[model samples]
Target: MKRIYNTLFIVGFISLFMSSCNDWLDVRPSDEIKEEYLFETGNGYRTALNGIYRKLATFDLYGSNLSWGLIDGWGLVYNLDKAPDDGGGRAMKKIATFSFKHSELTPTTDAMWDAAWNIIANCNNLAQQVENEDTLLFYDRTHERDMIFAEAIALRAYMHFDLLRIYAPSLLMNPGERTFIPYVDKYPSYLSDRQTVSYCLQHIIDDLKKAQSILLSVDKSASFSMESRFIQSYNGESRFLGYRGYRMNYYAVTAELARVYLYAQKADEAYAEAKKVIDVVESKKWFAASTSSSGFNKGNMKMMEDIIFSLYSTDLTDWDQKINHLSDNPADEYNEHYLCLGDELVNEFFGSEKSSDWRLIYQLEGKYYDYYYRTLKYNKQKEGTTYSKVNDEMIPMIRMSEVYYIAAEAIYKTDPALAQKYLSSVKKGRGIKNVDYSQVTSEEEFINMIVSDARREFVGEGQTFFMYKRLKKNLLGMEGYSWKEVEAKEENMVLPLPDSESNI
Candidate 1:
């Protein structure tokens, strides 16, 4: 089932708390905090930041829609072209036909698109306020302003990069020829058709570069010290409100930059950026996933070691009540939607030992069909309290592990040998003991292999469709039997601007 956009009211309520007293829904920040003020100080800035994080966790955006619902549920169920017309089902169904109009998608999908830009709007608003900051609360406005500005730019860059991936063509195939959805840098002014895929890619790169510049300006000591002082001084409730999770931290911003560069095919540059985090990225403890939750709870966003960028919430139990019921059974709490891999692709990957592969094994009775093995990485728990839920499971927008894969693939186009080194790093970690070094004979083969691994590893995590689009691979049957015949078109490359935004 597709996730509905019914919870937009909650988002609006959150927005109300984040806004200035003069204008609750408005994007602009004000100088003073009134009942309506959204950005009067560092705390208000934090609230605005929390607002963006909230959007990331919302049902319409990453929380359910972009993550499990759209990517896993819709894509998988529609593998044979069987898309439900439920509240969130349209995009997945329409994608295969290359027939989704701007008007056809659910408000949920529309809100995700809008929410990303809305984040950009917030970042812009904050960036302007921080640049001209005059709030009496800060002892040193310049230093604080610089850090906040960097985070804002990084957040904007992150949001824009995400928008481009879903709404643009592959960067490798005539990137200069394809159009992307509207690239809103300043506040969105008018609805525009797609730009050349290259244009969109370039736009992302430029924004990221700006983010890197602003982010680089921040003093590392100051990063930890500012929040530390706030925590030390404030009481519990005050501290909780003060530390509301928002704003791109240093690692999150850098991790996303590595990913953007990798997609742009700047392998060496991507590696250089990723290398900066090698220590942080490679630490086994950091990358180790938490396993405390059950069923759908398993996929809940918890603070894992390697989560460079993710959304968070203190209300997971409530979230569980709302989205958890959709899971078929207690132990079978994985994504209902997925890219139904055609028999051929599954056969190719599984070989004769298909049943031995963990991903191909069916654990639950009802989850599998004759040809399919439902993914278990996101399994929900079988038992829990009425309000039982998991934390540390947020929508993973970026992660350090992605840096490994992106670095591997990006380098394939440049240094094939070096690319293999990076590929082995991940493959070895996944327990694929001693992969044949000779298997990656050429760039194409290497890319194909790595991407295939990516699909399997990141299954139900919302990375596949963008990847297929980025590689310009034939949509049909790229991975499996039923999908072997799909071909995405120009219109398919970039979804039309949503009518809601266009009409506005």
Candidate 2:
């Protein structure tokens, strides 16, 4: 068994950077090498897990497209003022318009697909190693092996969930057999075929539940927060025990479960998971709501305290400067991906509390940028000194406010009053002196309010699109278009699968 495990780990590690699982299986390195050193110690096991996270934060993933670049364009988060053929210099126009099949979009579509699976492949490697790992190998920390194992499971499920959302149709309304994305699990997952929509949802839910059971206990003793998850340097074995916020800590796994359940349209399960996080957040004080305007500042624009789970990308500082662009000059490098908004859209979108909505007043204010509502959510280079390294290079994956949104959306139809209270919590946290849920009287209105808040809260974080996609909400007016709203359809909603996938 030991010899067999060693061979598998060695082969898997060799293909860690390969673009696809199929490529991963085919790698025939000129010289055989062993990664037995990595699994021999508790921290060695940790090294494998942390490597998965580093890959997740790359420019191809959350550090760029998944957060504020390509994904946001699909969410219609930016104003694509230039026409592609007009040769006006901005390529964001084509992406924002969602030219999925366009030749130029192929590299991105392919990269995203490859990047996701590559990271998933890493998860598979760490997962298999940790599951059969000897408890004694984890040294003095009790249940540490389970912690690593559970995070890998949750991360794998989280990746599959996104793949389903991005590559398939929104089955909440248009339930059909036509849409599917693979639910990859095993190492050398080359044979994992695309599954039905419902099939994928069940597996995602099951994986999260499995992770939840292990992490619930693992995280209680660990209780990782944004601050707790770090040290002066990540140089020691003890470093693995900290940084719960960076990993799929208990709350993060729960939050992710809530997100998955909601996507699965299992509102009751979603509500329970989401509400559980909201209830414990204040008591545990692991993660919290931003009670003041400090979070909206340029330095803390990703709102460090409110984050549930995030990626600490080493490349973040430099990466955001180009994408969260502030240049009035068109020729600025990577300016085509620049994200911005008009002043009127900001006010109209947030409703009556627009005056106190810190997102508008502080996060989108012009003091730091060349244009109105230009976001500093990702870019902090100009104000880097003010931002603490504790939260620097961090790209948010989930936040406290999203838990509330999930809870409210999950229960809105069954219990409107309580659902409104959930919305009011996020509103109050956002600097609204008077939280109001009066307008959310009807289900349609309540759903719209949630979508509206998504636009306001998830400006460049690349969340609003999934929210819009899940609910199939029309793109709320803006984007320099006064015409009727664009209806959500498979063509516009589903990101075209790369040829590797569609061809297969």
Candidate 3:
């Protein structure tokens, strides 16, 4: 496993420099060029940064397991029993059933741990080089240099937070409890000690603050807003320096800070951060809610209009092929493998008088599995082609809708009317009529409404599990197999650290 880890790291890092010649740092390397040469120029830093994103688009990380395949399946949003009894299906069953100790899960768990840390390792390497005086000398534009560093810091924090989300107990459950997962900033040595969850979260928050500060400094506009500069910087010729929604820009960092605060249960702070993002994004017209019926349809790479941050990957077809189990021929249904949506999800989201919700339109009737619904969310096939021809597939990582949810939840205790307004914005965007706050009887009911909306809004995006874990709520689907049942048998809310770390 260690050997595999090292091999993956080396390949990923090398590919960072070799993969792209345009937009990315485009220097050709000499036969004897050392690793140090790669960071001696601004282009080198840019290439290195792009490399991190490329690695993120691979099968192990956001491209698959972290998004629709493993994590969302674990959320019990899908009918895991319908999955074939292959290695992938067995792993999904272990995750869904909360059978954390099954030996079959070792490979999946180990891959997640290694891939996250591997990205962190690359982050540390980039930070170390970028901070050097010699590297600073190569910066033709200091703003570009600062922007690169800011993104690196933010990306590092994001990866650490995700690692904690996967490997440590939820803050709501364990508060300041120590976890086996170490908050690694520097490249890891075997001697690293585990940090408390509180310590890790604080570290993540601090890094995001640094990123926010750096981004603000780069903005020379009268408003001194990084978001404004990010918009202005996107002239066609200067695309390299322009901050796209796909990149970790100022608003993305702010959105992430709100998420971290919500996880920490800092309601006031979370509300403030979320509201700040909402105001800036709306005022600037950075994104709009998707009201089109074909918003999530196949062949469309951009899923919505209100995406705050996403990953542009040519490898989206790989993800598409993995989940495209539906066929034109009914005969293929028995042999094909797919993740089926749970009846609970279908009924809760689509079984309402407000059936006009655009999200509901993506559900296709399953010919193979009776009474099952298969999602076209991952289906990227074109009109005539068997698969998507689109290379630049945008996989949404964050969006404006999440901010509204966070704001609504954070302020629900003090300002029910305001919270309901925030929640109503999401519903209004989805074509549902304005929600009457008077109809909501209690705080718990309002919270459930927000959770339910989130379940529908982010069905295949791999956010539902994190929502369940954070709120410590029971899974609404699967009779007798809710999170409450799993919580009873589990010592902690998270999967155990892999043997590699446990042995250490």
Candidate 4:
């Protein structure tokens, strides 16, 4: 039987105290109200927006699967061993090998599809309600209505873009090609046509543009003239109020614009958008690199300033434990079930630079267990707070370092000097020596340097595969295996649609 996907019509709002104690941004809807009542008030719209964020923090999305789990496994970065006869390791092996044909993947893909679409459905419902109602009627204290509406639009675009990355072909290989994932705006009627990559990207850009316009207007308003007003927390006294890096704010929208342009192969456009963000970061001094050797150490939330958009999750420890603790014996600390850094990547890519790079020296290590080098980026659990306290570790969705990388890649063709400057910005931030563009003899060498830096910078963040796919670069294998580039016609680059969509 095909499981019917339904929207959560009634969303209950949780108190700030309770919300902080549990999931980072989950809005537990305690009341069963009609959809009409839910959208009638400004608080209703806000609650609905919070619910969307909560859905994104699920195990199927950024909380686990998308970040350090399935996606990174697919990138072939880890050493994945086959499961024992107990049958628990089959799914892990399939994900590590990129074998999506396993029956286990069906549930994973299906959950992703359903969760993403359900969030989109809610965003559509909120958007329609905002259009139908008057801003003056609802409590306009915080410019709540417009802000919530804008967030909904931006998040809708964000989810759609991720879906495209996972399921559609790279635009480089199949420009103007159509018919993959649907660009769903309205609630699905079970008959939405599959959209082309070009069409979906255009729609996503349109939504982000709308959100940017709304936020700009809010920034210019007389009562709340400060730009921080858009990202202020519900609790006035909270330390995290002004630090709205957790929410999709203006800068995040701009960053996403740059990313989308890069994915669409619009180099010039991407360069411009990325430069705009770089200029803003410079003018506002909104970010700084981690100076401490243990800057990205586990249990640390000090790097929040460097992050542009991060999803809050109190259940990070739980998720980390589940992935790291695969053995039946609790005392076995050296179990091989954990994912290790690729041997070739460590030997070839970071050969000489590994010692100087703090990102490598501190972030990547094999000290957790013998012959098991694991990434501690996501291991942020405090010593005494396991299963009892809320850890503030966030899943970084976008960061300032990424913006610099984007700018470097986009402008390297037209302005090599300027591109090198942008690239060196990240290098300097990471305490590494600056790169001399004049020293780089060929464009291919420059590009390879950029990709290598990205590999080092974004380890365990699930960006390596997308970087490889977007550039059609060869997927690097472990020491014994030969590297092979993914062909344009390869079906594995993008996952197949779920059985529900196929059945429909």
Best by TM-score: 2
lDDT of 2 at 163: 80
> Model-by-model lDDT, in order?
0.53, 0.69, 0.67, 0.65
Give the Å error, residue 308, model 4: 0.5
Q: Can you write out model 2's per-residue Cα lDDT over 1-504, one digit (the tens) per residue?
A: 111111232222223332221223343342222345557777567667766777777777787778877777677675544112221113345566667777776777677777787767767788888898778888646589888888888888988888888888777657577646677787755455667889988988888899999988887676455456543345465566766777788888899989888887788999999988887876776567667775444356666777888887656766555454435455553234445665456666777877778777766645224334566665554444455565567888998888899999888878888888888887877787676666556788887787777788887687887887788777653565342256787777887777666643
State in Å the error of residue 125, model 4. Answer: 1.0
Q: Which 10 consecutive residues of model 2 have the lowest summed lDDT?
A: 1-10
Q: Local error of candidate 3 at 354, Å?
A: 5.5
- Badly placed stretches (over 4 Å) of model 4 are 1-6, 9-32, 82-92, 137-142, 219-243, 292-302, 325-334, 367-371, 383-392, 434-439, 479-489
User: How would you order the candidates by TM-score, starting with the best?
Assistant: 2, 3, 4, 1
> Lowest-lDDT window of 10 residues in candidate 3?
3-12
lDDT of 1: 0.53
Candidate 2's TM-score:
0.86
Best-performing candidate as measured by lDDT: 2
- 322 in model 1: Cα distance from truth in Å? 7.3
Better candidate by lDDT, 3 or 4:
3
TM-scores, each model vs. reference: 0.73, 0.86, 0.85, 0.85
Candidate ordering by lDDT (highest first):
2, 3, 4, 1
For model 1, state the Cα shift of residue 274 in Å. Answer: 2.3
Clashes of 2: 1
